[model samples]
Target: MSWPHVIPYANPIYFLWLAVALLPMIFMLLIKGKRWGWYQSLITLIFLYISFGGKYWQQGLALIGYVIFQTLLVWCYHHYRQQKNASGIFYLAVALAILPLTLVKVIPFVDGGAAAIFGFLGISYLTFKSVQMIMEMRDGTIKEYHPLRYIQFLLFFPTISSGPIDRYRRFEKDLLEPPTREVYAGLLNRGIWSIFLGFFYKFILGYYFGQVWLPLLNKSLMHQGFFSWSLILYMYCYSMYLFFDFAGYSLFAVGVSNLMGYDTPKNFNKPFISDNIKEFWNRWHMTLSFWFRDFIYMRLMFTLIKKKVFKSRIVASNVGYFALFMIMGVWHGLTWYYLLYGFYHASLICLTDAWLRFKKKHKKQLPSNKFTKALAIFLTFQAVCFSFLIFSGVLDQLFFHH
Candidate 1:
């Protein structure tokens, strides 16, 4: 028995697999007929290609089976659109379609097939987009639903792997009218820049640090404590690693989307530089934060706050901040670590807001200059790293006192 080493790569197998899979999309771009059908098939294929990788073949028949079902869903939505104009019907259809994914994702939680079935890499994203598309269709926001375009939108390879999570409207706009040459060039340039930066951080720097630190960090947590000050230090390292890690992925997603002529949302905007937690969210995983804000926060704010439950700024501030970041944690994954991740972030944001308000009472003494900006960036970065520590679950190890 020996320690086995596996090397990660921009492997040729992966590239060839992608090339073969994306052929249909290329054909769709060039040919002038039945664009939607070709595009949908291409999208689905790309999803499979990117998500499964070399091991994707293990589930071969089942994977194909899933795609086929989703295709029928595409047709069903198209036909439903043709027959009726009710937005609720489309929403219902999407809701119905999601049951399969929900079942697949949730069942393994109690069953034995967790890896084979549950915890699918891309299902979370695909499900979100599918629901979004149908809702948009019903709302009159999307005037038409070609089955192919629907497939293409849901399964586009670049986004399928992981996503910056574009909405259907933007994808539809791109499909009907892609960017101009200059735009494509800009996209390509951006994509390249993004990928380079992402790889350097995620791959190069991340690899070196993880190789040296993760094992030690893991050991320290068990020997030390999970909630102690020791965690505060390793949490910093975890935060750094997590930043380069996820930021790298987001960078790739943005760059890749741009090259493909679709404008996925900007996922990060130097979030560590933000002066407040709300602003930090704006700067980090910028997409998910907004997704929760747009789809969850604003709606809840409208519905919940208006009811006048103890109406106070302090109350509203705490409630809104808690709900936002907790959901943000849950969005990371359906796990306890993620749940705590949300709690940690919400705490920071709440405390930060409280401090700001307190500082406002003594406004003239507050720092305001380049130094302040730099300090804000440093503090935000550290705060975010603390969030990452929770996210990574190492906080349980590093801070353990028992």
Candidate 2:
């Protein structure tokens, strides 16, 4: 038997089904001030089925196995962390947690563009959560292991595919305690507003910029060739398209989670208004950037400093930025463009750091003003748009495929 399938937030029609599925949960949360666990579980499974069932059954099977694998690994690590404080065991567990995702990412490159059998959408996000849990276990932050709850956190349909990446402990607390009536009323209001705003950003602006204007811009650019007026138009158009499309999806995830009384973290925060590349990262993809900062960069810096790997703190930090962004780039894909995009951002960030330091040293000489801040924002915006053009893979298409 065939089943209906839909990508989460892919179109307006999906929202109709989402509204139907979420209405009961929303009503219950509003009336009773508590969510029905079984009902929520049923909703999660139904959505999962819609997302990965039918022709995507293979992905569904992979998701099941992946969840079970991570759950068991986390359980074992939790037990070990309780009994022992060995770093090797913790590192091994973290590696094991990410191994499936690594294979999934690597397989397509080696197998002539064939996806890994164990691959599914959201594998990367799931791995991030699992690794986080294992790290917390190692640090004794996550004191106890509850397999069922852990699975629920991993399988939470909202923000599962792309994430604002909630911490396990935060999620657990929200799950255990529904918000107060007053708090829930505010949350419901915000949730409804976010959904409406998402429709405007996604269904309206995203469709106009991405589906409508992007193709026309691309066609114009092709005729005009590189470095033409059309190329400049394509750059800005693609950047806006990406922002609205992704920001819209994230708003939906957060809104839906809010309706269920879970306060999922917000992802975007007016990234284009940033004065520098460093600020842009803090605003854009806030969760992913913060994840790398917490899990990878911070830890790596600690290790380096502890071992005296670099005499200069500046050198150490610059190296850390490169490593962090490079890993992030490769995580996006194995493609050359993705790798270069990562390096490009890393370079910009490092340069921004250097400039900030120089300005600090020359405080009297370099005056800060509103006009300077505005200029900085404009320059940073252009730089970001160019990077997005690289990320769009248009260069690859223009050069390699042609």
Candidate 2's C-alpha runs over 4 A off are: 1-3, 112-116
Please count the clashing residue pairs in each candidate, in the order shown: 10, 0
Per residue, candidate 2 scores C-alpha lDDT tens digits across 298-383 of: 99999999999999989999999999999999999988999999999999999999999999999999979999999999999999
**lDDT accuracy of residue 256 in candidate 1:** 58
Total clashes in model 1, counting residue pairs 3 or more apart in sequence or in different chains: 10
Residue 233 Cα positional deviation in candidate 2, in Å, after optimal superposition:
1.1
RMSD of 1: 5.4
Q: Which ten residues in a row have the lowest lDDT in candidate 2?
A: 108-117
Residue range 336-396, candidate 1, lDDT tens digits: 7888878887888778888888888988988679988788878777767767776776645
Whole-model lDDT, model 2? 0.91
The candidate scoring highest on lDDT is: 2
